[model samples]
Target: MRACTFVRASKEVVDVADVAALVKADLERARDTNVTFSRHAMRVVPVETTCFAGVDEIKEACKPLIEKHFKSGREQTFAIAFERRSNNTLHRTEVIEAIAGMIEQPPNKVNLGDPDLTIMVEIVKGVACLSVVQDYEKLCKYNLRMVAMTKEDREHAKATANGNAPAPGTKKNDEEKPAEAAD
Candidate 1:
């Protein structure tokens, strides 16, 4: 299976060769082989190295491309999403609502999330992945993973369990203390 790198790029003026070169450079930096770029995405195979440090890096790297390719001299917004399950069924409306809820935006505004934008992603096997979604309704056809709790929430839970106190370095055992002399 070919591994693809999806980039949310600007719809501004761009050169396909430049994009391809950039993708090639990125893959080489990551020590990967078999890299290719499509009109909206990039794909690579035999990914042996790490070219992208994180999602932010990927986004940053593609910002210029997006601006170069999708810029229409109009204010626009967009989202990035990916397809997860290869066999899950999705309802258009449900997907839209889910995205809206996730982004804390109104459902109607999803389509307007980004205009003149295209979804970018790579699919392994039968999987379809688009990181940014302008239309949530389009996402209901895939099986997505459950949203995990934020780091803040986990920390808050631990602190609450510890009586709002910082975590102690070690556990104190009352059992080790002389049994209270049967008081």
Candidate 2:
């Protein structure tokens, strides 16, 4: 697997190579193996690393870089995401809204979700590529595993699969329950 490193370090555009080297060094310090560098997003500084399990490690490796580069007063949130190219059609706006909602911030206050001043990673061809998020939340939402079906839904699906009818008290439609007996 590949890892992507996004940097929100500087307002002035910085070289991709510098970002890549910073990530490589960080991963090396962590004793990561089989590492390699990948591409970056336009106007975003990112470095790709190879053989990473996931973005968690990539995020850990980036803390020092973030402190060093993104020293501006604006509180910046940096994130990393990974996926195969085949699954890359995630919508950018939806992600921003979800993230904004999660953080309780307005989307516009968060700035354009795309080309977000952070890094993103995608795994393709066995290489971890680094790119910038045009929308920060865009990549973030993909990381959300499908909402686990509600308990009711899971029970229903299980019942159907087992060829059983809904259990008692498991109404198929929403209805006001009968008044409970007085305790």
- Tell me the spans in candidate 2 whose CA falls farther than 4 Å from its real position: 1-51, 75-83, 86-109, 112-116, 125-127, 131-183
**C-alpha TM-score for every candidate:** 0.26, 0.29
Best candidate, TM-score: 2
lDDT of 2 by residue, 1-183 (tens): 234443455534454346545533533432233222323321223443333423344344444444454545555555434345434444334433333343322222344344345444554543445444333443223221111234365456657778786567676556777898998
Score residue 34 of candidate 2 by CA lDDT. 25
Q: Write the per-residue lDDT of candidate 1 for residues 4-118, one digit (tens) a residue.
A: 3444444352323344334335444332222222333322321111223234333444444344534455544454444333334443344434433433232212344433332
How many clashes does each candidate structure show, in the order listed? Answer: 27, 10
Q: State model 2's lDDT.
A: 0.41
True-structure Cα RMSD, model 2 = 16.8
RMSD per candidate (Å) reads 18.0, 16.8
Candidate 2's TM-score reads 0.29
